[model samples]
Target: MYAAAGANARACSRRGRSLILPLRPLAWPAVTIRLGHSHEADDVFLFHALTAGKVDTGDLQIEPVVLDFQGLNDKASRGELEATTLSVHAYAYARKHYRLLRSGWTFGEGRGPMIVAREAMTAETLAAASIAVGGVTSSAYLAMTLWNPRARTRVLPFDKVLPAVETGLVDAGLMVHEEEMALELTGLVCVHDLGEWWSGKTDGLPLPLGSVVVRRDVDEDVQRQLHKAVSESVHYALANRQEVVTAVRGTVGGLEADLADDFLGRYITDLSLDIGDRGQSAAEEFLRRGCETGIIPDSLPLEFAPSAAAEPSSSARDGARS
Candidate 1:
């Protein structure tokens, strides 16, 4: 009798007769939201909960559009994605179409993109030499230009930047993402640390690297929902750090456990969970400098999505510590 009722119904006995009762609705039809992000470990760890169904997203069925940061930035420039991760530098151009989310921001407190070369060189020498950059629109590029506007740059894929440098295709490479970790192994030396330079320039303010933004045309209610969902996802991932780290390592090829852990420690901080006052200030200052240096075309006041009212749980707060 139970088998005959099928999976959607519950078997019950009524007056010694078999009765079939419909089961409660499991969930409402989910609204599909396309979220674009890089395929790096940090991004993978940040969204692990949402993509893996470890956290409730209400009615939202988040669809991950995995792309390189440059690709995601390009999509954001055209307002093609519902939500996307964008370089803070790219955000200067993309601000017309999207608003930043408080969560999902990566900041470098004392470290960031580096200019790596085959041999040690002075900043003055590096400024005049040809350098390979991950992307012209990337924050790293913006920082590089600001550090030395005369630096000759050629665009290459982020992953290819190192190889280009190794082969002497360029005098140095402006390295971002996990490529920084491979410096010693590749026999390259850091000529300049952009993040450290920026921090010193800004009087210790963090260097804004990347952030998630939502399309400006998205409904306010939906925007709020996305904000809440992403915030919760970050919190969930934080609360389950080890699990997320393990999962990210498995999914992102060549990402060893130690590397993943170190990357998360460097990036996924409280700032990653929410770009607080200092983070906002840092981003604004970074962009402002970009415009002043003529690297960025325009400057606009940074606008952020409304944050969820609920505070993070104790577990989340605890787990946020590196």
Candidate 2:
């Protein structure tokens, strides 16, 4: 970020704003957060602020870094990024390589994976049968394993899943997140909702999707500042819906209002603040099972720092649900 026109102004580029919180002031080093399937609105608010200069660096400076939906966690592990959006599975995988700073995630009520067959779910399909799936840590894979522990699933990048499904390369593709409903246009039918299935298996609780994570090796104050600023930015972006829509179009390629609106509504958690007791517990149970089954190792901690979460804010009271 630079001062321009002798007016002391910052440039505005992406949809997100730079963290300019008043409470904590420091000329912090700029850091990058790789986002793939994070809340598009949050991404817009943040990316625009950091990259395009819409937001100022009052206490901290964050540089917006973009990565493919699949490469986010990988980049963080390689030290290519200090933070990134991660699926629970991706977080588990990355923990083996990097320190993790936990923040809010985009989980929702009853969202889950769909088998996504253009045709039909046949009983006999087995070896050599293909299925289009999202990248390594995507919720789709999480759903696949949870739904049927015995099945072996293949991991594919996000953009390629649709084309692969359309071409019949995979007999079926597993779809999750917002695409569970959106993929109907491509003749993709839902064989199951993994989140819903999980709910049935363990009562009513939102399925944990992906989260905003930072490297644990960073300074403690930096993490605290990030936690507060990011929380505020997301809340502020929700207040200015039009700005977020404009930012999404400008930064993330597609900017159609309907798509942007839907994306925002879906990924932006009304339960956006802290990981509630139930949510945290769910993470632990999931990790326990995932480790026991060899889906991931047990070294990962379900609670990154439970004591660090501050008291709940009134902002979420606006429309706090899932």
Candidate 3:
């Protein structure tokens, strides 16, 4: 009778174990997201908050894939990353694989890519001369071609473009990013400011340069989460500008605190946090013009990841309009 009682207890224990197993919560593994962006100061500043764990990313683990803008653009074209910063020109090709995020755009209101030469040249002469561009798919190149269809171009690494012009290998180099700010030091003269020209052409719409995009295959919920996280990151960076700038100064060699602040100020404005309707119109118009010029094979409808929080605040909208 004792043995029988023990057996009965063992059976009950087994049944209890089975019943308890079904009541336990499931633990899902964290998902790793590969975020591709350029190594420039502005890009570094925008992502510093998230990368440093200042923002709440929940289950998403962001892995930054840092590269030059062109390399990022190339990777975007191949659909190699979960998220990436792409030149507006390259987005035309990558739009099929990715949807642009509402945050993390670089728009030049009136100052942008400039054509620089060792010596001053007339617009007609510069248009007819050989120009070295960072990449054929760079927004600078597209704008250059649109501004002057007759200009000839050769592709070179962005850093090498200035050197190529200095050595007289190319009559001019289209300067973008920090290079655009270094013309005075390099003894190069600006032939044209593409942003200025674009503004004039588009009735003062800012020239969209770089934007972040997420792969379409990502779950909609995760996309929204990521967008919110990025927006938070931007806000964090802005709120703690001095701390973020000081942290990122080492990334770009010789980047003084003042210069870094100025650079970030130029690119990471309200639009970086949430690209408003005007910013959207500017991107659409840019791609539309690319299609009309036959530089881009075709344009895809711009699709943004859905996030209720992604809508621009009134201040952002007003700032974008300004």
Could you give the C-alpha RMSD of every candidate to the true structure, in order shown?
A: 7.7, 11.7, 8.6
Report, for every candidate in turn, its global Cα lDDT versus the true structure: 0.82, 0.59, 0.83
lDDT of 2 by residue, 1-322 (tens): 2434443544455568663322323232444433333434445543443344444434455655555556675675565555566666666766744443344566656665567666666555632356667765665576577666766555676767777778877777777665643574687666556777777777887777766676665544555556665555555566666776677767655456777676667656655455667767666666666788777777456535222534433343222212
Candidate 3 lDDT tens digits, 210-321 = 8889999887666887899899999999999999998888777677677778878887799988889999999999989989988896765789988764444445433423
Q: Which candidate is the best by lDDT?
A: 3
What's the CA error at residue 271 for candidate 3, in Å? 0.9
Collision count of model 2: 19
Order candidates by lDDT, high to low.
Answer: 3, 1, 2
Q: Which residue pairs clash in candidate 1?
A: none
Clashes of 1: 0
Give the residue spans of candidate 3 off by over 4 A: 1-25, 309-322
What residue runs in model 1 are displaced by over 4 Å at the alpha carbon?
A: 1-28, 309-322
Which is the leading candidate under TM-score? 3
Quote the RMSD, in angstroms, for model 2: 11.7
TM-score of candidate 1 versus the correct structure, residues matched by position: 0.86
**Model 1 lDDT per residue over 1-322, tens place:** 1233446566788889988665553333556789998888878888888888877776667999999888898899899998988899999889899999999888887899888999999757876889998789888888888888888888876678889999999999988855665676899999899999998999999888889999887755567778887888889888888888888878887766786788788877998888889999999899888898877877568988766555544353234321
Better model by TM-score: candidate 2 vs candidate 3: 3
